[model samples]
Target chain A: MTSSAQANVSSPVRAEKPQRKQMSDMTIRNLFIAPTLLLLIAMNVFPLFYSLYLSFTNYSAIARKAPVWVGIENYVNILTDPQMWQYFNTTGKYTLLTVSLQVVLGFALAMLVKEKFAGSGIVTTLILIPMMLSPVVVGLFWKYMYNPSWGYLNWLMGFTNPSVAPDWLASSWARKSVPGLALFAVVFVDVWMWTPFVMLLVLSGLKAIPDYLYEAAAIDRASSWFQFWRITVPQVAPLLMIAILFRTIEALKSFDLVMGMTGGGPGDQTEVIAVNLYRKAFLGQWQTGEASALAYIVLIIIIAISNLYVRYLNRLREG
Target chain B: MATIELRNIEKRFGETYAVKPFSLTIQHGEFVALLGPSGCGKTTTLRMISGLETVSGGTIHLDGANITWQKPGYRNMAFVFQFYALYPHISVRENIAFPLKAEGMAKSDVYKRVDEVVSILRIENLLNMRPGKLSGGDKQRVALARALVRKPAAFLMDEPLGALDAEYRESMRAEIKRLHLSTNATTVYVTHDQVEAMAMADRIVVMSAAEVQQVGTPADVYHAPANLFVARFIGSPGMNLLAGPRRGEKVELPGTGNIYTIPAPQREVLQAATPEGKNVIVGFRPEAAMLNEQGALTGEVYATDMLGAYKLLHVSFDSDTVVHIRCDRMVSHPIGARVRFDLDPQQVRFFDATTEKAIGPTQSAGTAPISVQAANAQEKAA
Candidate 1:
């Protein structure tokens, strides 16, 4: 504490080392991480496990009553309901359309700007703008653009032949087994907003491929088409899988875009599972028990998709 | 077998020439090495031959057909990169099959070719394993197999052993030479290591500052470098050079009154190449000097280095110059021990002090000095 005490040690500069050694690594790790750890448990972990508990019980937030175990009744009811099946089918169609289009367009765009040119930085920044925008805003903006009368989209379509331009977001869900125009419209907007993210990932993967590989391929007498399929595509596959995994899970939880544009309108044509879950939890039915069960079901589906994707990623890396 | 000829082949990047115009014809089945330090355009020259890099001027003839502007894939020359650029996602079998598959070869035929090639390389165990799982030596074997599978017109290897460990490089060098002996493929190898070039190449092309210093057989280049740069660059410790003005038939050592007598043949060659009493540099390899008490040149050992196979005495003549002399491995030459030595009359070389070109005897004399264009000004500055 004093200069005389410090003088007792020959190397006064390194005296702090002894005090540092007093703190065990475990205690130091906990000391630094305790705040973030507590906050994460309260915000993320508590809700996750508590929701798993509630998935098997009957409880209403508004009723202010303790939850009572319902013995998987909510799960049975939700799974048995044909409306829930329709909503899941709608989400699956949306995910399939959005993720596929995004992967193709993303990979193509990544290839285009792979070699830097003048203003490529500006072009990349412009492309990434949609991903940074609020999803609800994008959804609302596209809904306005899909307006039948005096909309930018319909006006542009009118040039090609106005007669062929059908209603964009007004198709009925009840009369069609195939996804309606409204679902396609929502899928289109999601592709527009998220393709850039996929492009960024693919671009990094492309950058990691050394130039000598291409030179060697050319020397081996491989055509450009052969090189693309044999070299470029395989090298970028792992990162592409990661992009697909992210987009699929995001599409499964599609809510904001549907809420902002169709709002499950045109006779519930675009009622994805997430939108239905929101309605059941908060808006109309106030069925918290069914909502929790649905949430768990979605979580399980995500885990399953993630498991398959992780396996694919591992296989890709192993090569 | 393929014959490749480059007529005045040179490469330029914008205004700077990466390789000054020079020409050489590689005979069928010859293993020619483009040897130089880094950025000396050896790799670029190899790339030009492979058609991966375009020549700024001059034409390339492959088997007497003009292929200067041919696309790399159409040329059918296999290029082995320094880093074995094996297709990472594919197994070794698929990688070796790739070039064949591109030509629309049948699946069974591809497998047969792969089997034959892998058997030669003794890498049958590696066929199913992906390239990532192979060791450095195994990866090199797979790369060689991939190149060999195509039976390409020629092989252009760009420092193929540069990335391997020292032990791997030695074995791989011998393996490549053995493969060349069997296949008899016209191979152009690029390397910075002189030992690798001397060990494997049928002819070594030494280049410096984007110009060809000399192109000759390994022994020829070893004994007869074309200029000062070649003399200084071609050996392990490089050839020792001592500059002195001619005094009759002897070279007058500047500070000391010691005079080195010129041998009869070299004396004739030097007198023919130069005016009387002109300053010239005498070049001799480390082994060319042997201890002689009655020898004209005298020096004390400044340092001693043990090279396992032999010993090197760093003999200091004056304040500025010290030359290495090789001796028997068991011999002891402590530091500061006074020793006199005589240069081997047969192995001694002469270079004009100003021009730096070799004042060489008729038999070992190379062509006139190539005008080294100052493509990069900084090189001259340094």
Candidate 2:
């Protein structure tokens, strides 16, 4: 029996199959998925490559001529422009203010609602309503609410003192006296719309913690304050960082809210990078090449920051 | 070490009572186990002693001081959870040092204490490894080290070995017993596994459906169960019980047409404890009954089991009544074979069929007969 088994293993036999026209599994699978792959490449990959090609050349939408190879001239011009630096500074400040506020307020709200109480489900759903709304719709509604004359905020402030109703969107003081107020108007709108997104992520993180850990800590004679610092904070830190990373990227590329609320106005006081790119590409000179270059620069910065956060997240998971 | 006394402690969630009013006292350095099936209030009782749950009706005294309303942190006890609950982010050294550091101990002192505990649990090699990197048994050792570092007022373990493999559980059980002897910390363990309770605890408190059934030494509970619940719950495969009505000097087993002659002593106790024309249950461990050529009780062998160290023959007197008889390993009985067995009257116990409470000489000395009203109240509460 052993010799026969060894002989069978040593010998290789080949058998011929009957001819058929049936498709193989791999071919059938690829055939089914072909349409989605084709549509994705056409809609997304094509535009991305076209924009990269346009970034290094002189291209104008209104020119009606073939774009000329400029040999890095668009990148050089955008890199050296003082106005571009100012736009970057504006973008940095807006990202810092909005994302930081969203993280702090979002985590605080998540902690508050982590435990079940009467009507908590309804309250949590209501809190998430703002994040569920379309950004365009939110911007449009907030614009009317920021109107200096008949806005609800000004009217509500009219109750205390009818004399001083600070101009929200087009305040001259925002440009001359306090430049931050102009930035604050748009930052407030963004924070209101996105804080709920951060809250939902952190809430899931909070929910993943088991109750026995806290009970064990209590038995170990750890105070409430000690439990918060030692247990609660460490358990939620990774998710909180992820929330911050997402909000930072979204804030850096902010355009719709700024456009609808302040239009980068009171004289470019709130002209973030995305809004400036929009203005350069479509509004006035239509410098599509320079705008594309600026867009690539923003993308690189976002990728670098996101990579740092991802590394930290991996380390946290390992720990 | 400290003595923990609970006086009529009860716990309620909304309108449903999780624990009925029960009182117990744990002497200093005594190891007590709360043994019961799932949802039988064993864990709840352990949590109350640890001050992790609030008592709805009574007070608790730790070392003669009232600590009923004190916070769990202030109660100065350590809890080992079923899943270990070791902080996943911390190293074994840091996890063991947590309770000490929380008390504002000096860093040098904390390290020294952690080293001592790690050596005791033989987890010194795993000091720098986080819980996430450790195996389940290693994590359990670290959890035990953490609980042992502080020398708290008492230790409360909620099925700490329940998650381990069978072999690991055996070693951990011995480890816990050794630690209890060396540390002499008052310990309250909660588990549904009767073997764990019998092996490690000095006294086992058996509970059923939010009520205490019996509390006694391991041998006492096994040899003499207080009620039907305790009798059936404390043994492997449980005690074999035959229910029937008493007639003259024998029990006429219902539906089996079989008669078990009651021994002279047991017959007297059953007659005094229960009225005539009422049902009675004869209880005996599987090991207490043996095969004999001259035995009067006869049945057909329904099944046979070879349990390595011994053989068990499951004999059926009728379609409904079956009893197990333990025999020597070499004694093999085939299925459908006729067998005769005799129960050792010295190990036999009788129970009142109506109240389900033990009716024998072995019922704890000086205990009052359960009144009809109290039995009715217990039924309604259940």
Put down candidate 1 lDDT per residue, B86-182, tens digits, no spaces.
9998999999998899888999999999999999999999889988898898899999999999887788898999999988988999899999999
Model 2 ranges with Cα > 4 A deviation:
A1-32, A159-163, A171-176, B253-261, B363-382
lDDT of 1 by residue, A1-319 (tens): 6887767774755675777658899999999999999999999999988888888889876777899999899999999999999999999999999999999999999998888999998998899899999998998889888876556897775534434455577863233334488888888899999999999999999999999899988877788899999999999999999999999999999899999999987778899999999999999678788799999999999999999999989988877
Instruction: Indicate the DockQ of the complex predicted as candidate 1.
Output: 0.73
Looking at model 1, what is the TM-score of chain A? Answer: 0.86
lDDT of 2 by residue, A1-319 (tens): 9999977865543123322235688888999999999999999899789889999889998899899989788989988999989999999999999998998899889988887999999989999999989888898898888776667776775633433556667654322455568789889989899999999999999999999889888877888888988998889889988898898889989998898888898788989999999998999879888888889999999999999989998998889
Predicted candidate 2 versus true structure: per-residue lDDT over B1-382, tens digit per residue: 5998888888889888888877778889999999999999999988887788889888899999999989887887888999999988888898899988887899999999898888899998999999989877888889999999987768899999999988799988999999999989999999999999999998888988888888777876787897889998988878889888887788887444468888887777778877776789989899988789777778999998899999888889888888888899998778988887788887888888888888864433344432111121254479
Report the error of model 1 at residue B329, Å: 3.3
Give me the displacement of residue B326 in model 1, in angstroms: 1.8
- Judged by whole-model lDDT over C-alpha atoms, candidate 1 comes out at 0.86
The residue pairs that clash in candidate 2, if any, are none
Q: TM-scores of all models?
A: 0.92, 0.91
* lDDT of candidate 1 at residue B35, scale 0 to 100: 94
**Winning candidate number (TM-score):** 1
